[model samples]
Target chain A: MLGIDDPWIWGVYLLCIFSTLLCLVYGLVNWNKEGEQEALEEKEEEAWEESEEEMQQKELGM
Target chain B: MNLLLLNIIILIYLLATLYLGYRGWKSTKDSEGYLVAGRKTHPYIMAMSYGATFISTSAIVGFGGNAGLFGMGLLWLTFLNIFVGIFIAFILYGKRTRKIGHNLNAMTFPELLGKRFDSRFIQYFSGIVIFLGMPLYASVVLIGAARFMETTLAIDFDVALLVYSVIIAAYVIWGGLRGVMYTDAMQGTIMFVGMVFLLFMTYSHLSGIVPAHQALTDMANLVPAKLAALGHAGWTAMPVLGSTWWWTLVSTIVLGVGIGVLAMPQLVVRFMTVKSNRELNRGVLIGGIFILMMTGVAFTVGALSNVYFMQKLGNISINVAAGNADSIIPIYINAATPEWFVYLFMLTLLAAAMSTSSSQFHTQGSAIGRDIYETLTHKKGGKSILVTRMGIIAAMIIAVTLGYILPENIIARGTAIFFGLCAAAFLPMYTSALYWKRATKAGAIAGLITGTAVTVFWYLFIHKAEAVPLGICKMLFGRDVLIASMPWPVVDPILVALPMAILATVIVSLMTKGPRDKHLAECFRGVK
Candidate 1:
């Protein structure tokens, strides 16, 4: 295939191209699919930030 | 090429870079902005920055030269680069890292691990490792860029070194990661264009892809005697398995760099720059294509350059380069490409150097400022940006000094040494931190220390590539390597150290108490 006799070499060459297409397709497919998760993560982020701020305050007091 | 036209092109590019740096400076308002681009970076910028930082001049010229010497077998590295480096990295690691980093309010790679495990010791220890180990890598990159300038622009080496350092330092220190990434995106675009052009030109020059590869494959009998002894079967085929050439190509170059990239602090930090998994998903598209063009083109052109040389000069690439593999790519470009394309290629090299160096400086500075100093002094975020800027200056000075002082042979080994060390020391702990809830602080520390100790021991004693040049083994044991055995000396430290690190992490974690459930919940929140 592709004029190279070695399966190890040409197999890798084809796989590189194939994997790149996989990434492209994955990206396009999931482009807007994370909307609900983003909202949940935002709520979680707020709670975590509050805790981190409290920890910082306690350290400053010490 | 006309000197005046070249100067104008360079000036225009530099001015655009400075303008982007200035824009980054104007936008940076807080420590978050400086440290991780306010964690709201565009997917394109994040992906481009990551790709550009990952591929450097040495990756192009040096490894490309290796491809010229070795064969299409080097394409295995490219396969691993795209599949492992981009796909698995973004899908599996990036999402979790971004979520956990946000949850913990972590700003850097060391900080993320430290905060997760509630271990200041881990934070500062990792920081110290990075601050100390990264200068060698940074200096080598600095030297590559300066040498390119010295040859192409006819500037003195010292002047090139100073000017290049000052330009990168100005943007990186002042604008921080924002400046670095903004400039990186632009530079990465240039690199993409240049590489794509090179691939097309090389194929066209050889009449097309299939015919060109067939021509190279037909020339397999031209393998030099010395190379054949070491394991050179042909240009289109893998080296004889288990030979020195096979071991060096597969173990040291392919696996060492391929797997090692997962744990690189600079690359890992980019995962924290974006806002959500959606951005990372988009980034995967850009990053995969960018890396494909970069390494894929370099290795293919590198292997096929042998065909070009044989047709035009009646010699192989190594012979044409006078046995220096690093010169083969530049020589081929000069001989085969038109003059205008040479100018574009020069910009490509410049972009590659600056992009990689800026990320190194940023990671090093944060290691000292945010991770080391803050943890040690019990200081928090207020003074971090100021201290980080100062740390960037310090790192730049150290890199410049090393660039001036380090010998070329030792300098050439910098990237591999750093990559191998990072993989050995950090990969186990980093993976455990992300995935294994049972992993304990004690386990992390044990893995870290064991990994570091084993890798250092290997380099100083067992790994012939480094041990010979370092001479610690020769001085102490009176041998080139501690083990004068064949494949043992050729085996990379990561192959030995990473498994040990994983075992240490797993065994010690099982033996010790895990982190509190509440903290683990906090870390794992939204991680899936």
Candidate 2:
């Protein structure tokens, strides 16, 4: 509380808070994937499923 | 004051990094895998490694100290870190870079340039630039961590510098890129945890969040006459334009590092490690969050340091007391934090220095091994991985020698020199490779030459290019005043050099017609 409450200084602070909040919002919304580990897990799951499907088809053919 | 515990913590951190390097060395499938991490890094590792590699001790020790000295205006860079550094870099650049890098099977920065443009000459030239120029940065980072060690532990500068360099270079030479990443992942963890704790401790030390910030504002509004005249309105204030403060805040630091991140080879190499574009898409959020924590916390704490120094020393800055701005954070650490916290911070800084140093060494080695040795010498080596390993050793040796030779104030000078060079040499080619189908070899060459020449000329002669170039050093009302005041480098080179490079690239590309590579153009096609 310097007591002046300078607009210019406070404006800078406001911008920082706004930007941080904005970054936080965007960051959370986009939190799903950023590193490939999550995607790799999904791909592995899909591959496992496809192999399982192929096994079923072969069993049916037999 | 017990010091043995601190020594043990640093040694343990060093041992872990060395172990990771040995593991990487033993498992490298070939040169490519060793150099580029097999291009199959899981997104989490990739993201953490990328963030870790970029968020060095320099960000924490050097520039964080600067924010404390300069005021809170430097926080703009933290915003840019998330938005541009992580988001735009990943989505806009990372996706395409990974796809093209994989398609071309390129493993190094210069290799990417050469393969993308079908120009080996470009590759070799870029390699030379990186190799010749990176030492300044490597040495500076070496110095940054060393200064912390020297100040906090009261060790000799040379011993600290040598020990840090040797430890980092060993991991990099032994482990290669995979080792760097695995180590980076760990270091990144240390940094994330350390900053989080440091942030809380800093706030607590101030008697609470509200009191801490209020103290900062009180100090800000009452900035010494010299600082006030230069536009240091407060901790939360931006510098006034044309004031000495404005140019420093807006131009040198803000531009030098903000855009410079795009051209950093070590960070760029991380983009190529993943298996797919989707993988790159995944690393974005993690990278952003890590950056927010690493950079955001550092800037916030750095700003808070002002209040601490003022309370303790009866002045806003303790920089002059330690004889270097980079020393501010360390002194603050020792004075304000508990001994255990000091050990943790030392570990965090050591992690930052080692992680970045190892990557810088690896990149330098790769530039020589993959980009130069294989391409230029045309030496059919026994194995490219072998060549890279050898190159890593060679680069480490050079870095060690330079680390010893450099004068004090290593961090700021180190960042500016390497980054300014990268901006000049790589930024144009990078922009062209991604966006413009018409970007020609001539354009790339023109841009490189113009940018490199201009940035160098300015830095050598510009005031802004020199020590704390952010302040009233702009060439307003003619640089004659500056030329008279300083010995050389009266203006910051970026303002003049960057435009010249862009203009040259566009003009040359237009004159030379489009590139012959249809597939190259297609990389940019199918988008808006």
Candidate 3:
């Protein structure tokens, strides 16, 4: 009988908790920074902006 | 009985979903917008949509049922889901996929690969496989949700399945990716809350996690003798290594899903929906949390249900719903949760089914409409959306047919089979297209053909569970599998076929010409 008192069982549970907390902390700390704009080539930036405008216009039309 | 209230709530939910689909329809003025949400979607929407699509009712109900039988070892899948399915996916694959998709103006996963290799054959081949293979997965999701309704609402199973199918088709055909994502975000939230409540209720019922697990572990002797023969050690412990149970656990269940996540067309396309790598990075944590709650709680609750059943009936078996393991969670919910909360959980189940099925339908539709037809006819724009809509209807019909006919315990196996198939067939070429500049078109085609061929051959002839279905080996060779000395039946096709695929890619690429330097430069542009 492998019970909750078993060290191996506790190890598994702890690993899960540790991994989940790591994700949560990392996410919260870097949330804003991650979605910040990245530098793009001028040519690529113009094309991206044009598409973004098109998307906005289409949404407004809807 | 609150039946009328349930109906009204369900009706209102349907109307809201339809309204969202209509909004998506209005905004979808072109092919790019319809297929990929204009590729400018917010990180939150992308994350929720990705999470919801990945963790369907099958994970909650079917795999939850599986957890009841397999025990805590299944938590390994949750770790993989967060690590591989979310973090690695978002950080590694998502960045490259989005950048290359933008560079190539590719709208679908197969198209992304096809354009990368400059091979129309790769495009059409992938499209056909997705159109054919995805229905098995989608139908299982449909059955999972319908079973919940049948058990909870007392509706006939067939009727529940039909109604569910029709409603999902209505939204997916109308809304495209935008509609799917919008509803998925809403659905994802419902799933998160519902699972959290179920977890708390479970722990509170057993007093606490420690007590619940302790009780479950104490009942290890209660494991059926037949299961013990198959190498089930105990609920709280991993199976004995090199045992048949271990093979099934690692090869079929764990690796089949863990590695398979990387190649999923529906999940992969979500990476391309966002604008930049930043959006993917932002999505990583939310996706991880969503997967953790969705899968972790389900597995825990599943194992603990044995304790609940034991306390209530002096028996510890998932036999409440006619001995079907798939119904363990649904039946448990009926016995455990308050009536009002059951109604809320019903929405959660529906969300799980619809979110995943809609993505499948949408992807399959796009595969046929954009990847296949557009590749052949060279049509573009609003016309492509029309073709996709038609394809959605076709896909729904096929999935609904499969939903009606599939066998018991098909939920977990069906999900695994599709994931395994995708991993075997697509992962090698897809990885090379992103990272390996020396990969050739001939190598990709060889890997694709050989990989798909081997998986089909294995599933039809050699796979122990599936051997008799086709009856090729049983009739001709007087045995199910040629490798009688090895545990061919227990080993997953992915364990066999994925390596073969990589081998095929490497050998053929070494023998043939590689991608053009200009093409490689363009594909790898800004990739670092």
Candidate 4:
């Protein structure tokens, strides 16, 4: 009643969020090329994989 | 104001509370009864206590009123509460916390913290932090209930606060934790029934929304431009994305409360109250239902208030007169609803506020009296019950002072500060204690210190100055880079601080020798 607009505007916003995330993927190269940051990412990737595998095994048992 | 009826209701409520306290006083003979309610409570009572303790006057008055300002978008928080805060908390955290707590024979939060780390220092320090932090939270609950009374009965705000405070303090001081839980059950029932009735009334008033919206849609462009600046394309819908409204809604309100609730010290202690993990598993349904009604109904009614205000007042919407968002729910209740409904809503709010406040007061009081006082000073008091009762009085005074003095923000802001602090302070340590065999005392100390300090630093210094400055004095001397550039900092500390605490606890615990305490191995066998 306060007159913002159609309820479907919410739908447009949700779509924009997806597009924004896609843009961020394309924009990732613009981030600083620091070696330490790269190393940190690789280290985190390994940890993530290990944790993921452990979790999968736990799920299989359950 | 119908002074006589209001007076009689308040007086009778007060008298009943005192008599109940006296009855509890006769039964309480030892430290065990005072703190843990003899550990033989039914799931229903414990569930009510858990629900009551979590849903406060802040939720009813502060968040309810916010629905008037924000539309129904805030309903997400209620959903988060039942699903994440209540269901998962009991189903996952409660079962584990209660087992560990019962194994340790812990009575207070600090005791749990201390026992977990094999460090009396950690427990004692945790107690100090809880005592220091909780008054700010407790006082807001007092202010919320007082605001409702002031609006409904035409009572002075100060007078309402004092009356409510005295009644609660008297009962809590005399009766201790069991008395608090008994009254919480009574109060929870009052809140449940009252909110349900008010929701029905608000719906009837707002049911005419189709007509009202038709009337307002007639003048769509005439909508104020300021609201666009207020970050909405329209009131009937959610906030515009990337607006300040969206950020606060998503980052702070929804995510903060959703993730943050899992770590609340008062709630975590509720987990410790029952006999077994099964009791906790049972509490999930009970807590879920209570949260759904208390929160779901408030938001539904709040969203409907817009239609009511627009139709009756010939305005497109209602603007909150007071700067404090806590006043919004009271304003809607008073302005548009029938007078009889107002009285009932007041009682509902009193129940909501008192139940939460008493839990907070006792939790904080015990944190100071039994946790820190017994652990550090080891003053060897002959009568600990006397000290515990006095601690309750002191806690009441601190909360009373804060409630009367501090201005209101939305209730969620205070809730965030306390729960955020809890999550930062205790969550990582608790997780490790339950499952990670390597968790050391030093690692716990790091996690607690790093998490708590960083959370306090961020919420106070980085967040906007628009709301009340909840403990920013310390950050004034310290530096903040994020606040310098942005209007307000968007950094929610949990995203940053929590992981740091977890990582630090794990890394440091692995580096150090496991706990040397004799009780350490026995604790792991508790759940087994």
Candidate 5:
């Protein structure tokens, strides 16, 4: 049977698999970061509060 | 007997898709909702949708068929899909794309670029390229799905093509991005489950992974003479280095699609669909798993199919039995699986086709309607939506026409060509726009033009693959390529075009003055 004799070739294949697994692990480890729902809601609220302040200041000037 | 059950299942799928379309229609109150799902999509939905759009029948049927012929070496593409298409795309590109897209209120990829550069030409030009290039890619998806149906259902090829096109077009035109993503999530689930079963069944059929690969390797003498001439060493091993097969596999297929994923307008627009970077981040693992199952399984099963065919049919190769490489997967599934599983796999294939095509139609429609016509005319509100719908219809027609005309064994080549074109034409300028503070409007335009021009010139003139069929070089110069002295006869366009584009961008930016301070401040706001 014609089989792969080179150890380095197998190493490359293993490396590819290992890298993919590493990526998967990286993704799983960082599943819920500070960048998801709570952070987005906080940013939106800040924007809303700033807009409301600006409107109130405009009314006071008038 | 089974046809009636298959029909019922398809009818159910159609009804579900229609219902989702109605929900999308209701959710779409304004242009933003229709275009980018209002940028509040959940991580699960966004992740699944991105995976579905990114890995379609082109990966399963087209590239799977390729793996069957070319062997396990195609697995490198699987690695690239996960590493580049999913992880890097989400972490590096998706984060910045989402932030800047939100900051500029950009609806499409072209709009994001245009708004970032503060130039209407960059926006309209990229839109026009998407409008032109995406149809060929869409047509390949359409052809892949139709080929599967024709083999599985025993329907006329023309009828299958028409039915596939009509169903996907209806949802895309009526429901927009929301409808597209909703269907995509469901479709992605079906594809994952179907592929998992396929991989398991393939391994079991071959008596296990080691023996299966050993059998394939033992049959190294079975390599077609034509393929061997092209430097194919064996199915399991990488082709001889720098051989035509090696170049085709590495440069054209692997690097082309791997790098091309970053610049796809349909996929890039997906990053903007999520709410926060966390939602986008959450999508990374889900997308990773989904792509792994879809592509990893496809390449494995595709290669193992040779073992199955060899054991059963004596001497008939996959290409001989299926008549064409594109039809090999369906032919093998029909022979290998039970009746019930075949029916379910059919839906999985349909999901694969519809999800990708719907996104293509939507991206092209937005390119034409929102990016080109509306931006140029300064139109907004309901009028833009009307234009987009019309553009979707136009895209569907063009894709269907091309689907009918394309040749067999074209699914993989067509996919590679489009991906390669996108990489050459858009990747450099796109990456620079996101990361480079010194990138000027002049530089972006010059890069865009040079990249597209060089790729087209090479494909039409220098590359024997297209030149032989196009006959342009043969007619003008009595040879396939003008420069007959070149060592490599068929170098992929990306190898040459990408570097030229990158060089032009860097050189032009250095020569030009900095972009307006006001524009830079607004564009890079909150982007540290």
Candidate 6:
């Protein structure tokens, strides 16, 4: 196809380009899918961190 | 190129890198910030860091050099790298890893596995393996960057090695993952621009894409007798199926690295460096294009360098390099590109090397300090970071020493070896940790040991590429390989060890008790 005689070689060459387009399209389609959830996750993560710190302090007898 | 101008440009780049490192150091206020970029990295920075750390000088100088010798067959690795490394990795693995790691508060790859399975043994064992096994890989990367410096700047190799190591270590030890990823993003941009220019110049120099491929294909008859005997048919064709050349190309070069990318400790940790799946979704776009530019340009330029050399000097790339495939890309850049581009590409190679080296040192440090030492001593928080900094120094010394002692043309093979080992040893357990709820602590440990043992045994006793030079088989069994038979010695360890590890993991998990329901729930929390 691209002037290379081997189907195996040219097939992979085309596939590399195709795969990148797949990623670009996929990213664009879902760029903002979970926008609302991030804020909630951050709050939960902070709570989890505080509890984790308390548990570690208890273990160390601090 | 003007040495004075080049030196000033390099100084600016170095200063900029150090400035970014300082910014990272400034932001890092706790163990979490140092370990995982505070787990809220930007999508662009995360994607660029991942791609830059993943590509490295190994891809450009080493495998690009292999493309010079072997042909466009190496493009299959690029296909797998994009499809598997970015797309599947980000969508399928990244989301789950981020959630699970957050739930368990796991900072490193070993800690993730350790926390998931509730086994300190798994964490420390994996940590020990990484600490012991990664220097060979790191050293080869050091050698790749050093070789380019030697070739382009006319610097001594030893001086290049020492200077490169010190620069990478200074930032990695102080700034941690935050520093590594920040610099990686900037370095990745430089690499992207340099590679785009390289690909454009290559095709334009050869009069465009089709003409370049046609020229390479036309020169098939020039395949050296030695390479042809090993089943090298042409620069544009696949090696004769099942021939020695085919096995090395497919098994060692292509699949070894292509599939192996999934389990790399350094690359896999990037998945846990983000807040939510949205960032990963966005990252996939940037990562795909970045990887395409990096590997695609290098391999294409590597292969077409032959045509350029043939037309100019009536010799092929390997001959021009005097049989060292490692030198092909560097030689081509020096001979084919204009002077100004040479200076830009020098920064490109430097970025490639520094970005990856920084990540390796960080991962190795975490393995030793966070995973092994902290887990063993029951110490946590600030003390571990101090130990981690020490570990980084130890890793730097080992890698720099190896850069001095390791033989020429070892870059690509060394990289493949580490990737394959990680695939066999960690992939099964890592996969099971994410997807298989039934996977038990006993099962994970068994799989880890069996995969590691089998890979080490194969490298020492059967894989001729490593065994012959290692001479362990020759000393123990009075032969180069325990199996001197055709194709047996040629088969890569990943092909052998990975399947066995998977089987052991599945069967052992089924036979043993699974993790407690409470632990499993904790691991699976928020992990849709």
Worst 10 residues of 3 chain B by lDDT: B314-323
lDDT string for model 6 (B1-528, tens) is 799999999999999999999999999977888899999999999999999999999999999999999999999999999999999999988888888988888999999999999999999999998999899999999999999999999999999999999988878999999999999999999999999999999999999999999999999999999999999999899999999989999999999999999999998899889988989999999999999999999998999999999999999999999999999999999999999999999999999999999999999999999999999999886678899999999999999999999999999999999999999999999999999999999899889999999999999999999999999999988999998889999999999999999999999999998789999998998777
Worst 10 residues of 2 chain B by lDDT: B480-489
Local accuracy of candidate 5 as per-residue lDDT tens digits, B319-367: 5555577877888899888888899899999999999999999999999
- Measured over all alpha carbons after superposition, the RMSD of each candidate to the real structure, in angstroms, is 2.5, 7.3, 3.2, 12.8, 4.0, 1.4
Write the candidate numbers in order of decreasing DockQ. Answer: 6, 1, 3, 5, 2, 4
> TM-score, each model?
0.95, 0.87, 0.94, 0.83, 0.94, 0.98
lDDT of 6 at B19: 91
Which candidate, 1 or 5, would have the higher DockQ against the true structure? 1
What digit string (tens of lDDT, one per residue) describes model 2 on residues B123-220?
88888888888887887888888888888889998898887777776777777788899989899899889999998999898888778878887776
Q: Clash number for every model?
A: 0, 20, 0, 3, 2, 0
| Candidate 2 stretches greater than 4 Å from native | A1-62, B229-231, B319-323, B380-384, B464-491, B517-528
Off by over 4 Å in 1: A40-62, B406-412
Model 3 segments more than 4 A misplaced? A1-9, A34-62
Q: Which wins on lDDT, candidate 1 or candidate 4? A: 1
Name the better of 4 and 6 by TM-score.
6
lDDT of 1 by residue, A1-62 (tens): 89999999889999999999999999999887664666766676567556655765675552
DockQ (C-alpha) of model 5?
0.23
Decide which is better by lDDT, 1 or 3. Answer: 1
- The second chain of candidate 4 has a TM-score of 0.91
Model 5 CAPRI quality:
incorrect
- lDDT (CA) per prediction: 0.88, 0.75, 0.85, 0.70, 0.84, 0.94
* Best candidate, DockQ: 6
What would the per-residue lDDT of candidate 3 be over residues B113-154, giving only the tens digit for each residue? 999999998998999989998999999999999999998899
Expressed as tens digits, the lDDT of each residue in B342-447 for candidate 4 is 7777777888888888888888778877887778776423245567667788988988987777755736567666766777788898778776767899999999
Ranked by lDDT from best down, the candidates are 6, 1, 3, 5, 2, 4
Please write out the lDDT profile of model 1 over residues B201-256, one tens digit for every residue: 99999999999999999999999999999999999999999998898888878988
